[model samples]
Structure formats: structure tokens, C-alpha cells
Target: MTRVKISRVTKVPASEAPPASGECPPSGIRLTTDDGDAAMGLRVVGIHLENCGKQDYSVDGYPLLELMDKDLSPVQGISIVQGSGGISTGTGFDEPARPLVLKPGESALSGLMWRNTTESGPTANIPYVRVRAKQGADPVTVTPQLDLGTTGKLAVRPWTRPSK
Candidate 1:
């Protein structure tokens, strides 16, 4: 069985400029703050999934991605909002379990919104993120050393067809 891998997970700064027309961004993951206020405790995290295996792979239901804490456990009160319903770009509003096929060397981009509820500052404990192709598949967990400041609500987007 082929296994999907997490090539890289980057923290996109709000100050980063958008891509030029018809041009793709550098990192697969994009992070943006709501209301231009990173201190206000709202962030949007985007991810690009690359297929590095020799065989093709399939993903469904938001790619089953999760932001894990230091102990490899999912944070509390984080809501996963699947991008299957056209709520975001790339993902389509079709079946809940839309099969996203990825050939070798291909990649797909997805977004997730994180909202902080607690008054605590930055989650220094969170050091890694976990991802899987689908349910029952072996999850590929990696410590990208991402600093998710404090705890909050996370709305995840599903994996979709790669844009040409």
C-alpha cells in the first residue's frame, strides 16, 4: 500500500503578498489573519498536499488533517469544516466524500480557519500536524514545528482536485 507524506507545513504571514495573476504561491500552505489583526486571534491556514509516492493516492473528507498537540493529540474545541461544499476555492460543493485523486508529483491545496476562544496566548505546546489520505488509512504525522498561538477553533478544508 502506498502512503501519503507531508512534505512541508509553513506558517504564512499576513504581510505576505498575494500571487500575481495566473501565478501560484510559493508554499502549499497559506496563513492569513482575519481583520488584519493577528492579535485578535483569528487565522486561516492553508495546505498543499503533494503526492510523493510512486503510486497514486486518494483523499476524502478534508484530507483528514488535524493540528496535533505536543503529545500527538488533537486540540480541543477545533471544528473541522470540510471544504466539500464550495465554501472555499478548489473544493467543490458535491458529495461529502468526493474522491480526490493525486498522481505522483501532483499536489492539492486546502485551507483551514483557526479561531482562538481562550484568553491564553499562543499554543507553544503544539509542535506538529497530522494528515491522512482517508479513513482507515495510515496517517502521516509530521512535526513541522508550527507555532499555533494558544487554543482556538479550527475549520479544516477538504482535499480537492489540483488546479492546472
Candidate 2:
């Protein structure tokens, strides 16, 4: 899991600013990976977002999740499957904002799908998920590697979430 800080700008002086109510610093946000599944010539990658702060947080745009090889090159035939179908692959924006909200200590799950189109066999690559809380906020990228064994077909279970 990778932690990232949310960016905030305030005009109030540090001393004069209101004390933190329940909100957590951006550092409390985390990106994690679940086990992936490959079956019936299809690959499903599990992605997760964890909020460990005292307050809730929201993701502004489509969660940036990509499948890439060890050399950091985009893997062919892998694409993020958006359930909402509102945002296109390029823009990453929706007509109406569909922000994902996670309360403190809560986690959200997303999936990416790919088909093994090669004739040789199943190829091994890494799944990476990038997240940013708001526009102009610093983004964090987390890539966790899992071994699915050598086979032309693959099936991986999602990783278990850590206990609080």
C-alpha cells in the first residue's frame, strides 16, 4: 500500500486556523492492491483504496489504474473497465461528477480487465493504480506484484485487506 497527502490551501494563519475537526491529513490516504484473477482467457485485476484518516475523502476523477510490464510499458490488450461508463479513456472526466467517497477506515474496490490475446501463453505484468483526492492534488502511484505461476491461462484472487 502507498500513502499520499491531499493538498489543501488556506489563508488563515496556522495559529488562527481552526483546529482539525475529524479530517485526517492527506497522508492518511492509501492505495492498495488485491489479488488478480485470470480465467476463461480473461484477466481481472483488483484495485483498492483505503482511508486511514479521521475524516472522509473523495476521489475526483476516474481512478487511474493501468496494467504495465516490468519495464513500465503499457501492456497490450489491457484496459480499465469503468462501471459508470460516464468517463472516456482519454478525458477521465464525467458529465456529472461521480466521486468515490471513503469514510475513515473504509476501503473501496475497483477492477481492471484484460484478455490474453497472445498465442504463445499468458504473459506476466504488474498492475498499477494511481490516485489523487482533488484537482491539482499530488497523486500517488502504487504497484504491487503478484506471482500467478507460469501458464497460458491465469486466475488470481484479490488480496485481503489489512486489519485495522
Candidate 3:
């Protein structure tokens, strides 16, 4: 018998993330993403938020995400679930969101998860995402290029402190 590797995760360090076109000012925070990973058709992209302000920054719950097309218009018919929702077990997204206060230069994380399987109808290829660290927060656009192949659902993890 032989064993073959079926999945792998690709981590893109924040220091090396490609330049994104989104910008939000006066919020004292910055949003960026990793290159993303695909494990056996399950896609995961890490969303990172850092407090770059002079004072402490706080957030609780998941980051609000609005999927957008290349034109930056909202994409319809897609569902954003809070947890894995059975999409895949053992994903880190299952953890509950807790309130976090980050000092300047500290960072927190969340993630976008989905599976691309085209069964019927058209596929969704999102070129941009409008993200808010919390409700009523200013929106910042990010280019993750989500390739949702008719899955019609995306899951998000809660904001959490990065493990030391």
C-alpha cells in the first residue's frame, strides 16, 4: 500500500503579501490577506487586521464581508455562514468569536472558507471583497479573487488573537 498527500496549506506572510488596492483611514486599523490555500477543493484565505493607531483597537465577532465582482458591485445569491456549517470539519473557523482589544502594532485574524464544485448553474468568481472589522466600521476593499464554483456559500471565522 502507498500513501499520497491529498492536501496542503499555503501561507503568505503579512510582510510579503502582494500590494492590495484597499485603504481606510482614521480607523486606526489595516486589513490584508494571505495568498490562500486549497485543500482537497476546500479553499481558505486568512484575513489579517492590525492596529496601527496610537491607541488600542478593539473588535468582537466576525469581520463583515461583502463579495464583489470585478466591477466592485455586490454579488447576489451567496450565503455567508458564521462557522464551518459542515463545509469541512476540523477547520479553525469553528472557534467562537470573542471580544479582543489590541494594542498598537498587535494583530488579529479571521478567515474565509469555501468549496468550489460546479454542479449546476453559473460559477461565481469574485475579484474583490468589501470588509469591515466590525459593524458600522468603515469598509475596505480587498482582492482575494474568490473562485466560488457554484457552491453558493462562504464561511467565516471569528476575529481571534494570533497564537504566539
Candidate 4:
């Protein structure tokens, strides 16, 4: 059955950035499946990079997602995976790469999914997630932050394969 529902919500972070101690950001990020696309028998997913706070700039660093518990605790031992380059469907290319650098007042969408490996099988005690970018780049810093809304929480699902 196809169902369309418009849910309205507003979320605000307690702070624009995390403290200087490296802690998980608060629970403000939300993930919702694109049922409309999936309903058409597609493997497409949508990720919303909501309010990531204010930062001077961002650049040059690998972004990663960290999973946490309901009490706002790290879910020790879990890997998150994401992909952006579009895939082929036997005819032609559907998505093309054209620089996905998002600035303030901007958001990016791509095909992404999360799985828990701290021990398998659909679990849903998600609390919050943080995005970490490695330090030291070049002219600008690309160090990802846990409060940038760039990181997303792990869906309450288990993994089918191990990340090595």
C-alpha cells in the first residue's frame, strides 16, 4: 500500500558546536526513508543534512559517522557506510558527479545506509550521531565535527557482512 504523509517537525541543537573534549552531538538528526522512491522499486535513499550549526569553513578531511545509544552513549563497535557516485541501471547513468561541497544554507543528498555490527540483528536504541573529519588539511580545515549535522545515526538494523 502506498501512503503519503506530511509530518512537520522543528529541531534545534543545544549548541552550534561541540565542546573541546570531543563528545557526541545531541539528538537532533533525524533519518527518514524515501518511501515514494522505494515504492517504485528503486534502491535509492535520501539523507538530509539538517542544521549543522555555524562554522567558519570546512574542507579536506574524511567524514565518518558514529553510532550512539539512547542515553547518548557510543555504541562501541559499529561501522557506517555511505556512497555517492551514481550507479547504472542497464540503460544509462542516472546520477552524475558535480562537486558535492555543501556550504551554509545548503544540503546534500545521496544514497546511504547504516548497519550495526556491535552484534547483529535490527536494534533500535539510537541516541545521537557525530561526524568526524580528520585534522590538518591545507588552506581550510576539513575536520568534521560531531555537531555539524553532517553525521547521521545508524538505523536500527544489523549487518549482513563485516567491514574489514
Which one is best on lDDT? 3
Worst 10 residues of 3 by lDDT: 8-17
TM-score for all models, in order of appearance:
0.51, 0.48, 0.83, 0.34
What is candidate 3's lDDT per residue for 51-162, written digit by digit as tens? 8778998899999988877666789999999988778989888998899999988999999999987888999888778788899877767777788899899999999998
Q: Which has the better TM-score: candidate 3, or candidate 4?
A: 3
Query: Which ten contiguous residues of candidate 4 have the minimum total lDDT?
Result: 137-146
Query: lDDT tens digits, residues 1-164, model 4?
Result: 99988653222243523333323234322222232133222233332332243432332223344544444456664434333222224211233333334444344333333322233444443435544332331111111112212223322111111123
TM-score-better candidate, 1 vs 3: 3
Query: On residues 13-87, what C-alpha lDDT tens digit does candidate 2 reach at each position?
Result: 232222254544456766544566666644555555578778877765445543445554555553333442322
User: lDDT values of the candidates?
Assistant: 0.50, 0.46, 0.83, 0.32
* lDDT, model 4, position 115: 23
Error of 2 at 16 (Å): 33
Provide the lowest-lDDT 10-residue window in model 1.
28-37
69-138 per-residue lDDT for model 1 (tens digits): 6555676654445542222343242335467777766766565545444565654445556655557654
Residue pairs with backbone overlap in model 1: 62-158, 85-93, 122-149, 122-150, 123-149, 123-150
Q: Which 10 residues in a row give candidate 2 its minimum summed lDDT? A: 86-95
**What's the count of clashing pairs in each model shown?**
6, 10, 0, 2
The C-alpha stretches of model 1 lying farther than 4 A from their native spots are: 1-40, 84-97, 117-125, 143-152
